[model samples]
Target: MKVEIWSDVMCPFCYIGKNNFEKALEDLPFKDEIEVEWKSFQLDPTLDPDQTKTTFEYFREKKGFPEAQAKQMIGQVSQMGIKSGIKFNFDKALITNTFSAHKLLHLAKKYKKANEMEEALFIAHFIEGKNVGHIDTLVAIAGSLGINTDEARQVLTSEEFNDEVKNDFSEAGSHGISGVPFFILNGKYSVSGAQPVEFFANALQQTYEETVIPLKNISGGDNSCDADGCSI
Candidate 1:
């Protein structure tokens, strides 16, 4: 009933995976009982904050792909995104370190809006062409979402939630998750990458079959509980 997802703000696939997961949940029979936990994952901790190139140029340089090829890849991803009701201008994205952003996400969890903040940050970076790595810009986005801007500004300047974010990082490492959008369901099964909705649904069903349905068929080991009574 619990799903933990490890993702990065700067990663495009993380956004795509979010869409896929949302779509999958809509069709899940027990959607109302599901709990979603967002874990912190940084794709590039050493990203230079002063880099002025657009996101596509950075990808082109870092990935060694020509500008034309970069644009083509962006076009492909954008088309895929359109199918899922997301619009991403990946070619012109700006890259930066997401550690601080992860810190804010951790802070947002206390307010029970971590999921919204996560999705907002993704949209800010990929769609609106905002510099999500900048604290001031981040505060503005958080404020627009009705989050306390002053508190967010203070947290951005201070070390608050730093350790919590780091703990999520450590947790991901302990789980052997090495990439963004890695998913763990019920702490028993894991599916890596931005998989399709059917893949997640099938994985859940398969886990239930292998782990839950059989137990339901077990004979009278605890008939008292089923009878809603206790023997005194």
Candidate 2:
């Protein structure tokens, strides 16, 4: 089955949802046959690009939450992240504009390493305290992923993939998505949020069983990650 996920890189729940969904996929009966897509969704499109504020400051100001409450919310998320083996430094994170980040993700997809880059970028921003929204940092990260550094730099510096990024956001709204971590399985079943692994597995198995003819030809040596039904 194909799975399309709409999420912002800065979203803590999206990260958690990603990890859980991966775990579910790892154990799926048709793991090799399933495909996954990560679509772009901006959590805050109107955020000031020139704002040099930290993530905590942005949350406190934009969300209108007190400092203590924001920290508490972050702390709870951190605990949840620990359970999923993803670390989050809510104190050190900065909530910058993620539009550029989304554009880079599209470029990564071309190199066939979008999934790996997505996970790395999420951890860099939310856990490693890296400035993912920064051009130099993104270029470096993309380079580290075996992508052409110069090409990555040009893409980040130029207006490359800007429209594609917008289309992703537009498609999310077209699908009635208001919040992130939204999952559309096989262009049919839809699930939202970073739900438990069981939820994703059940949805995937149920959908696939309905349409696919299970190939019993298992040579114990076949790997396929197709995007036909997937929506990354």
**Best candidate per TM-score, number?**
2
lDDT of each: 0.74, 0.76
Tens digit per residue, CA lDDT, model 1, 1-232: 7788888887776787788888988887878877899999876666776454676566666667688876776676677678768888765577777787898898789889889999999988898878887999889877877889999999999999999989998997887666767777777677666667787677766655565332111111110100111111
lDDT of 1 at 65: 69
lDDT of 2 by residue, 205-231 (tens): 877877654322211221111111011
Measure candidate 1: CA RMSD: 12.0
Which 10-residue window of candidate 1 scores lowest in summed lDDT? 223-232
Model 1 reaches what TM-score against the true structure? 0.85
